[model samples]
Every structure is written in structure tokens, then in C-alpha cells.
Target: MRTLTFFNHKGGVGKTTLTVNVADALADQGLRVLMIDADPQCNLTAFYLDEKKLDALLGESDDADGGTLWSAIKPVVDGKGGIKPVDAYKIKNGLYLCPGDVLLADYEEELPAAWTGSFARKGRDYDVMCALSAAAREMGQRYEVDLVIYDIGPNVGPLNRAILLDSDFFCTPVAADLFSLRALSTVGRAVARWITDWKTVRGLASAESRDKLLHGLPTYLGYVTSAYKVSSGRISTRPHDYWESKIAPRVKNRVVDVLRAVDPTTVPFPSNKLAAIKDFHSLAPQAQEYGLAIGKLRTHVNSGYNAQILEAATEFSGLATIIRKRMGI
Candidate 1:
């Protein structure tokens, strides 16, 4: 099983959209998929289930009973290891989601006491990375997960750090704008630093161990421009074309340069064009009314919606293929 986190330090880059819909697309192909909504916003959860039902699913027990991911994962962190099998978890059919809560924001402040002195050591407390990855691994082993997709928040805090470190790889769904470019660069540096830091702490001596640990480090999966205008089944106008063609290449080159400057082995992933979700205005209204994801909605379908979904799905499918090739899958 492989874990992929869809992330960016920039919000509103369609991170949740890519994570949810891409998982749906993969599920459509009959692959077992698990999506973890690591963001406090829980937007992906909203996309798949109604609020009342979602609350019931998550609120089945009080927080102390290990009802949420925080409680569910604490045992692993405490060294009482082993994840509940995938089938034991609350997943429906081909896909399951580990929803995140606002409480997730508190993890950093509560960094396990053990992590304090470990910074100067040869390796980090395996508990930190292990707790997260091991849970995913165990679930994958149990259910034979084909893919694990994580929808993370827009920060370099402990929660995001843990998610990035745990995932086999990650992709940034960034907007084609200056702020997004800056945020991407910032995240690139953080990722590079974290990878090196964790590796050094691991005290990796054997070439094999070094290879295994570094292998999981996040690599760029290229950029996907969200909310792009479409007309005649293509990006409209020279400005949009320039943004799509020249500007994106230029910024992406700089991002790649930054990553390489920090670590030459860091390579950017191939990217593809994703037209805006068609009639987003209409789709948003419909989603709000019906409590459904535009992609998951069965009624009120339109050509624009179909086109957008297909475009987004195809782009992510191409990304999945590239990633599979990288992992030699």
C-alpha cells in the first residue's frame, strides 16, 4: 500500500477537492482507497457524508474513549502498538476516511514529552513518525489498501509535519498565483529540512536503512492550477494561457530550483492542466442545498460539471501513474 498526502501551505488551492475527488476516481477503478481528512476544516468529510450522519459516526463515543483519530492513534504513540485492521475501521465499500477535528490543532502543544531531548540524538523517537505511518501501514496490510490519500491543512505545524513524514509521497495542489508560489516554496524548504533532520536523527548507518527512510520522503507531484476558466473545451484567453504555459513553467522551475538547491535528489513531479470545476457557482449552490459533493452528486448533472470532473479525474489519474512508476509499482 502507498500513502499520498495532498497538501500545500496555501489554503484554497483545492487541496481537499483533489484529495476527495481523486480518491473517488481511484475507487471508481476498483482500488481500495482510504482518505484521512487531516485538516481541521473537515471539508472532505462534508463532501462525502451529511453533517448529522458524520457527527454520529465521529461522535459514537466521548473523546476519552478513543472515539476520534486522536484517541484512536494515541495507543500506538504510547508504544502499545498495532492499528485496528482496516475492516475494523468505519469505511464504506471501496473507500474509508479518517476524519480530522479542530482538536487536531492542539497536537503541537502536546508534543509527546519524549520528543524534547531527542533532537540532538542520532535519530528521532521512532514513536513520532512510527505512530502515524504504522497505523496507515497496519490498515493497509489488513485491507490491502491500494492507496491512502491524506487531505492536510495549510501549515508546517506538527500535524502537517507528521502527515508529510508518514506518507510515502505527497503532492501540492497549488493555485497559479504569487501567494501560492511563495507558500509552495516555503513548504518545499520545510519538507527538505524535515527529511534531512529526520534522516540524521534516525542515525541511519546501513545503506539499506538510509534508503528505506529516505524513500518515504515527500517528492513534488507537480502543480495543478485550480479554478482555471474554460471555453471551447480549453483554457481561454492569452493571460490564462500565459499563466498555464509560461508562468507556471517559470514558477515551477523556481520551485524545483529551490528544492534541488536544498537537496539535489529532490525532483518535481509531472503536472497536468485541470480546468476549473465547471459552473462552480452552480455546483456550490447545489452542494450546499443537498449536502453532497459536486463530484458525488447524481442529480442536476450538467455538461459543465461532467467536463470539470473528467478533467480533474484525468489529471489525477496521470499523477497516480507517474507516482506508481516512481515507486516501481
Candidate 2:
């Protein structure tokens, strides 16, 4: 299965919302999709599960067991064993969710030491570094999924570094604002360095460990511009257009160009803008409340929301198609 991650260091960019809905849309198109909530915030998990179910999975209830992403990798983090098998929650016919845990933040503490020991080709350190990827692959194979999408927290932390390295492709979800524009350079520079560093470490690893290592080269799929207001069928406000106009040039200069300079072979896409997602407004909260995708929200609401529901369905469907085409799926 192909792995894709939706990431942006800037918060409040609707990254989790976009990831969940897009996975739902892909599932609707008959693809078996598995979503990994790698974010410690657990927002993606909360989106699909109610509080009681979430409490159980997160180990806050009497029925708690090994069902979360953290549960799978905890053994490796503690230097006890390889990753344990995790039973992903089936959200619908074709969509599944590997629940996230607030305890995931604790894994970050071990990463710094593992990263250092990796230079010496320490076997345990390699195991720790590759734990998440190995677990994800095992789960993907077990489920026979067509696509695996990861929803990571907003940061350039060690945990996120490992996730980005393991991913086959990544897309940035950004808002039409100054903060999102400024974040492009930070993400670009950090990823380039990580790729370079990973290459060095791979050469230092033993043959066996080298075979298990991914290339650490996640191709840029492009950016999704979200949370902008829409008129009849287009952007309504002048302020929104002004910021939107700035996105392409900034992304090209700050992100695409920087990445190309590091490894031209990895930069094959011609464009940086993937899709312009119109603001979902009321539909977002309604969908979240019911733990449903915007397209599926129609069944939970009255006739007055038919038009907005249709618009949401069309928007996410188009985004899913673009993503599939870009990935050559």
C-alpha cells in the first residue's frame, strides 16, 4: 500500500479535518483506506469515535487494551521487543482508523537518544527509529489496504521526522494567511536536512538494517489551500484573493525550489498548488458532531442543508481525484 501524510507545521490550518474527509472520500470511491492518527492530540481519532469508545482505546477505561498506535510501538520504545500488532477500528465499509493516543508524546523522549545511537549502527536504536514504519507496514499488509494516510501533529519534532521519512508522499494543508506562507520555508529546509542526514545514516548501517530502511525521500504532492470563503462558486473576498495569489510564488520559492536544490530527482511535480478547498463553515462542525464525512452528513441533517452538502461532496470528491492522479493510483 502507498503511504501518504498530510502535514503542516502551522496549526489551525484544518489539516486533520482535510485528512479525515479525504480518506472518507477515497473509501467512497471503493479503495480500502487505513488512516493512522499519529498526532498525539488525537483529533482524528475523536472525529470518528465517541467519548466512551475513545476512553477505552486510550487506556482510560476498564476495557482498555492494545488498540492504539502507541500500544503497537510502546514495546520498541521501551526496548522490550518489536512492534506489537494493533487492531485498527473499522469506521465504515472501506475505511479504517488506527487510533491515536495522548501517550504518544512520551515516545518523543526516546527519539533523541535513538537518533544519536543510530550513527553507531546500534541495532536497538534502528529498531526504535523504524518502529512506526514497520508497524504501519505490518498493519497495512494484514488489512490488505489500498492506501494508508497519516494525520500527524503540527511540528518538526523527532516523531514527525520519522513519520515524514517513512512516508512515500506528503501534502501540506495551508490557510491563506501570512503564518502559513512563512511556515513553508521552515518545513522545506527541515525536510531537506532530514533527507540528507538519513542518507548518511543509511550508509553507516549494517546490510541487514539497511535493507529495512526506507529511502527517507517523501515526494512533495503539493499544497491544499483551505478555509477560504467562497461566493457563488469562487472566492468571495478581496483579502482572500490577495493572500491566495501569494501562495504559489511563496511555495515555489520557499518550498519547491529549496527541495529541488537538495535533490532534483525527488522534485518531479510541476505545480505546487493541489486544490483550493472552499471553507466548509457550518458543515465542518456538523460533520464533526456526528462523526461523519461532509458528504455523508446529508443523512443526518434536514433538506435545508442539501445544497451545502452537495457542495461539500463535490469539493472533497475533486480533491480525492487530484490526489489519486498525483499518486498514479
Candidate 3:
């Protein structure tokens, strides 16, 4: 199965929004898709369920329950009846989600302790990464999933580290801002470190260990600029000149290239002009009348909102196609 992670170290960059929408879009295209909500905020899961539903899902959570991701992935891997299928709430025609739990954040403190016993057991029956890989593989086998979209949270802790080590390709979604740029650099470096360190731990190295590690590492698909608004000057004007010329190239030169040094196959996602999702204020409720996400508001007064969503969908679809082709999915 092909795994693609939508990640950014900095939050509020629309990582979960894009991941949910892209998974929906891919499902529309008839691809069997599984979205693993790896974020601790559970925002993606919230998008699929309202407050009451979330309460039911979290009924009487204890430390033993896989309410958190680390527990869930293990059972799926071991076939020990540990993993339970998510209910039909978010189940679409060709899409399913493992869903995220808020408890994931708490697991951060417990990861090293949980993993200590297996660290020294070389060639043992199980390792942390193997369990995750096995989970991915088994799920792929069961669902025959064409795509596995991982919606990861901020931070480079054990969870993110494990996901990076197991992912096939990653697409970073960052806001067009300075902090996002810095995060791009940080996450890039962390991914590189995880790859090399994971290889060392996997016992797959030899005299050509460095070369082999590079060969086995996941490809880094470059970042996507999200939540941008177009310039108001003219229809032809691009507001992201700073991003196109300055931010993109700097990341490519400083970060992507270094990762490529370890593995040349690493390539950027489509370098399209930033797909701008115009932020529209939701209209005042007329007697509690509802409307779609703000984009639908523009569809009535003007077609711009629909056009924007379509364009964003198209951009993600292109990235999806590239990822699929690379993974031969």
C-alpha cells in the first residue's frame, strides 16, 4: 500500500482540513482510501462526528483501550483482536478512517518506557516500527486500499518518528509564513535523521550501509502552501511572489537537497502556484438556516468559492496522482 502523510510542524495550517478533503476527493475518484488520523487534537475525527458521537466513541476509556493510536496500531498488526473497526459514521463509499483520539498526546511520555524492552532484542519477533508496518500492511491487505493518508500532528516525538519511518512519501502543508518555513526545515531534518537511524536499528546495513540506507529511505514530496488569499490588484496578479521565489526555492535548496543527498529519488510534489482557499466569513443565520462551509456562500452570490474548492481539489488530486504513480499503486 502507498502511504502519504500530510504533516506540518506548525499547526493551524489546514493539515487536517486538506487531509479530510483530499481523502474525500480521492474516494470520489474511486480509490480505496484509508485516513489514519494521527493527530492528538482529534480535529479530523471531530469533522466526521459531532459532539454526541465523539462521546460515544470515547465511552469509558481506560489505559488498556486502543483509544490512543499506539494501542490501536499494535492490535491491527498482531491480529490479536486488539483493533476494532471504526463505526460507520465516517465510512464513505471507498473511504475509511482509523480516527484520532485526544489521548495520543499523553502517550508521548509513555513511548520510551513502552518500547524499552524491545530495543535490545535484535531479530526478535517484534519491534516498534515493524508492528506499525505490519499494521499498515494488514490493513492494506484487508481493505485493498490504494491510498493510506496519514494526518499527523505537530512535533517530532515517537509517534511522528514511527510514522515517518514507515511512510512511503510525505506532503507537508504549511501556511505561507516564517514559522512555517522554519518548521519545514526542522521536519525535513527530523525525517532525514529518522531514516538513517531507523536503518541502523533495522539491521539491514553492511559495508555499503550508507548507500543501502539511502536507497531504502522514503521520498520527500515537497511542501504545499495552504490558506493563502490572492492579491486584490488584478485578476492576473499572484500574491505569493514571495512564496514562489523566496520560500519555495529556499526550502528546496536548504532542506530538500540535503535529503536528496541521502536519496536521489526524493522529489517535490507539483510545484503549482499556491492553491488559494479564500477565507469567507459564514453568513449570519437566517432563523438558524444552515449552509455548507463558507465556500458554498460564494457559490450563490458568485462562483468564486466553488471555483476555489475545485482548484484546491485539483491541486491535491494532482499530488495524489504523482504519489500513486511513484508508489505504483
Estimate candidate 3's alpha-carbon lDDT, on a 0 to 1 scale.
0.59
What are the Cα lDDT values of the candidates? 0.60, 0.86, 0.59
lDDT of model 2, residue 203: 93
Give the least accurate 10-residue stretch of model 3, judged by summed lDDT.
284-293
Instruction: List runs of model 2 lying over 4 Å from the truth.
Output: 60-64, 229-239
Counting clashing residue pairs in each candidate, in order, gives 3, 0, 0
Candidate 1 lDDT, tens digit per residue, 1-329?
A: 88888778888777776675566666766678877766767676666667886687567522444444554555544456543332333445687776555555554444444344335332344454445565556666666678888887788876677678777766666665557766866776778777776666456435543443424366665556664445457655555455556446654555666666766555644443223332354655565455434555544566657765455456556655554555444
What TM-score does prediction 2 earn? Answer: 0.94
Report the C-alpha lDDT of model 2 over 1-329, residue by residue, as the tens digit: 89999888999888888888899999988889999999999999999899988987787411225788888888888877888888988999889998898888888888888888888888888888888888888898899998999999889999999999998889988887767889988888888888889989999988888998766888899999975544357755666568778888888888788889888866688887888887777888899999998888877988899898898888899999889888888
Instruction: Rank all candidate structures by their lDDT, best first, as comma-separated numbers.
Output: 2, 1, 3
lDDT of 3 by residue, 208-310 (tens): 4223222236666666665444334534334666655656776676567777776666654445223443332233121012212222234454454466545
In TM-score terms, which candidate is top?
Answer: 2
Quickly count the clashes in candidate 2. Answer: 0
Q: What is the C-alpha RMSD of each candidate to the true structure, in Å?
A: 5.0, 3.2, 6.0
Query: How displaced is residue 35 in candidate 2, in Å?
Result: 0.3
Q: After superposition, how far is residue 138 of candidate 2 from its true place, in Å?
A: 0.8
In candidate 2 the C-alpha lDDT for residue 235 amounts to: 51
Best by lDDT: 2
| Better-scoring candidate (TM-score), 1 or 2 | 2
Against the true structure, what is each candidate's TM-score?
A: 0.77, 0.94, 0.75
